[model samples]
Target: METATIHDERTEEGRRLTLHGRLTVRVIEDISPRLREMEDDPVPLTLDLGGMKRVDTTGAWVLYRLVEHRTEQGFITELTGLTPRIEALMAQVGKANQMTTIRHPIRKRHFHLLARIGAWVEGGIYQFGTFLAFLGLTMLALVRALMHPRRLRWLAILRQAEVVGVSALGIVGLMSFLVGIVIAQQGAVQLRQFGAEVFVINLVGRITFRELGVLMTAIMVAGRSGSAFAAQIGSMKLAEEVDAMRTIGMPPIEVLVIPRLIATTIAMPLLAFYGAIMAIVGGTLISWLQLGIPPAIFILRLQEVVPLTDVLVGLIKAPVFGIIIAVTGCFHGMQVEGSAEAVGEKTTAAVVQSIFLVIVLDAFFAIFFTALGWA
Candidate 1:
């Protein structure tokens, strides 16, 4: 048998309720209806169970129900008279609730895989969206350039030239010179085995004019200028500078993008041309030093081996590379979210994606030209 009694009375500061009982399962069932009576008082209620004995899960559950019912009235609850047994029972119940939510290892792994797949899908979609935005803006810019020639600012174009073109010159120069030197040195070694060291000139010329010069120059620009554009524009976006430009009735694409597109388009071909010259010069120097060939003979053989078509082919690829670089930069910049880390990540992605696409495009051109009997 179970027994209990509740005495509710007023106190100096508030109301106090005392329950005295052997809190067995039957007693809890009887007291549940009485506990609901405490809700009439709007003041804070304190449950004093100092005389509670033999309390079990049923009693703890009754207490929980009372606390929940009191919550509906927005009254604060304080549970006192917590004996060790009652405390332990409550803790066990709470822990049991928590353990119910424990997940299996296989389930967790499945979720992890799903999360990764979701992330990859999201990335692909975001990149595709950015590419579309870049294309749309590019089309708009081209239309404006054709229709509103007087509105084009030459000063902005020159500044873009200085920024994207001149700023990238040193890196392009160094890379091309090193690439030329390495190719010449390797060619010289292979040619020396056959006592035909002079063919190294033809090797360097054909490789440079057909592949290395254009590819290396584009890669350098992608790393240097592409990243720069992403960082600059991403920072502007983060700081709301781009928004300010829009607020001022300036088309951000016209004021910012047009200059860059024109600059890179003009500068990239010239940079490719310069890279070829530097590569030839470096190869000639390497031939003179290692292969014991005179500069005059190296230059003569280079001209004879590399046709005008080869040079034009390299140049033809440059503007395409430039467009790729510009698009990647602007795309990643606009994709920047609300964090410094996002800017850095987007900038790095811009460079890597631009360079990768440039190389891939170059390969496609090579294969296409070969198929057309043009390579």
Candidate 2:
């Protein structure tokens, strides 16, 4: 590779800087200070690139900066004798640098607290609108799939069901079981003071089946399957597979989102029921071992005290929770941009949003059910 050289010539019209040999990183490093100095010159400047043997982004950037600086200072700066390829490369680099420079001005401004708060509110409103739009599109996709069952992807739905439901069983069961034991032990300690230790079974059954069972299961699914959905879809997006599907006349929601949503909705009620059963078993074991209540007695008390309606209440919430988790995950996944960091960021957002929405919906259900005298 030829070493780059810069030769400056001063004429009546302007100062011209002729670049020779390879205009690359090493050459740019050597000539950067010289280019900076040229920017301060009062005369108009012209850069002659015809003598350059090669050019890359870094070299083009240095030249772009010099031209921008000179122009900003009211000096006419021009490029002369450039081939089509180098001119195109320089134009591309110049545009990118301009965007970066434009962003810097915004960062330099001091934002007041009120201004920041207003900006946040504005962003929230925009995001809410976007989410509503997404929801509408998903609903349309669902309708289309229903009308044309042949468009439904049964294989994908089954695969996602296994992933979102069957695989999550062990962790959901263990979490509920441990939570049940804690509730029983605490209740036993408190009830013993009142000489009602056996009431632990009633407390566990009521709380687990009516509230904690479905709530805890939803949260666990949000953290596990929701995050997985985000990561999977985000990776596909990053690979341009989602765009490719669209280019090929495939609806992404139908191909990707519907299967996961349907599977999760189908699976959650079953998981919630399983978790409730596990929780009851754990409470019963603790009652038998610690409270000295026989297993038979515990079972009899649970049957007598806890109504079937209580169990049904929890199961009723499961499908709604599933829809929230699946939709939130898939929504954030589709929002991911073109980078690895974006994928990770959106995945985190999906889990957080899913869990937050699940809890919020649970609260609404609690209120509505209580108002209806179901609680």
Candidate 3:
């Protein structure tokens, strides 16, 4: 390898620096300080690359930096070169350096906060619109299925009912039963202070039938069946099966969404009722064992104090909760993009959105029933 050399000469026009030999990585560090000195000179600079030499990207970067430094200082800099390849190499290096030197404007903190809030509001509105559109489409599909009973997928509905309802019974039953025991135990503790421990039956019966049974059942279904719906449909979407159905002139809503919706709607009320019964049984057992309130007396008090309206309140909300969970899950499933990661993401989102919406809907129902003097 030839040694890299930099020879400076004083000329009438300016100070001329001639680069010679192989200007590669080996010599760039040694030559950089001299280049920086030349940049600081008040006189105009001319870089002469006509000398016999070899050059690579590292050497080209050094030369590019020298020119850029002089240009930035308002000094006239000239490059006299011969080879097309070196010129092209230097041009690319120059462009890359220019790109690196460019700085983006810093955003004001208050303005950025406002922009973020605006974006959040925009996203919320967009999601609301998407949900409303999905609801409308589902209603239309239901109407079409109603007009043509043969179009209804009975087998799929049964399969989904088993998946969403029958399969979930044990977990729902256990959760509600445990919740009832806790409520009864806590109510007994509190009521004993007022010497009214027997009223724990009223508290347990009213709360389990009117609120907790249906709410807990809906939340469990959202986490279990809602996520399952999203995962199943999302995987089909990723496989292009949903698109293939569309190409074959089958509406995905009719074939997929309606069955799940119908199955969930039928299943929720039954599950809620079952959950309520198990919860009452659990409370009765706790009352008997812990409070020394006999099973017979507890049952008699429950029947007399807990009205039919209390049970009806929760049952009425069950189908509505079912619809919300089903629609949210199916909507998010269809929105999944073409990837396994997207399917997973949409499945998680479906569960979260369904559960959140169920809670919100439950609150609204509570307020509405209270307004009607039913609570």
Best by TM-score: 3
Candidate 3 wrong stretches, greater than 4 Å: 1-101
Worst 10 residues of 1 by lDDT: 96-105
lDDT string for model 2 (71-172, tens) is 888989999878887778779987776434344344323566668888999998998798889888998998989999999999999999999999999999
Model 3: how far residue 295 lies from native, Å: 1.3
Worst 10 residues of 3 by lDDT: 94-103
Q: Give the better candidate number (1 or 2) by TM-score.
A: 1
The digit string of per-residue lDDT tens for model 1 on 1-375 reads 759888888887688889897777877678877876776557788889898867779777777667766887798888899888887877776566543566656657789999999999998898788698777887688678869887787898899888777877788888888889999999888878999888888888988888889899998889888898899889999999999999989887777677777788889998998898889989999999987889999888777888888898889999989988987887788778789999999999999999999989999999987887767
Report clash pairs, candidate 1: none
Judging by lDDT against the true structure, name the best candidate.
3
TM-scores across all candidates? 0.73, 0.73, 0.75
Candidate 3 residue 80 C-alpha distance from true site, Å = 16
lDDT agreement with native, every candidate:
0.84, 0.89, 0.91
Clashing pairs in 2: none
Best-to-worst TM-score order? 3, 1, 2
Q: 307-359, model 3: which lDDT tens digit per residue?
A: 98899999999999999999999999999986799988989999999999999
Worst 10 residues of 2 by lDDT: 99-108
Question: How does candidate 1 fare on TM-score?
Answer: 0.73
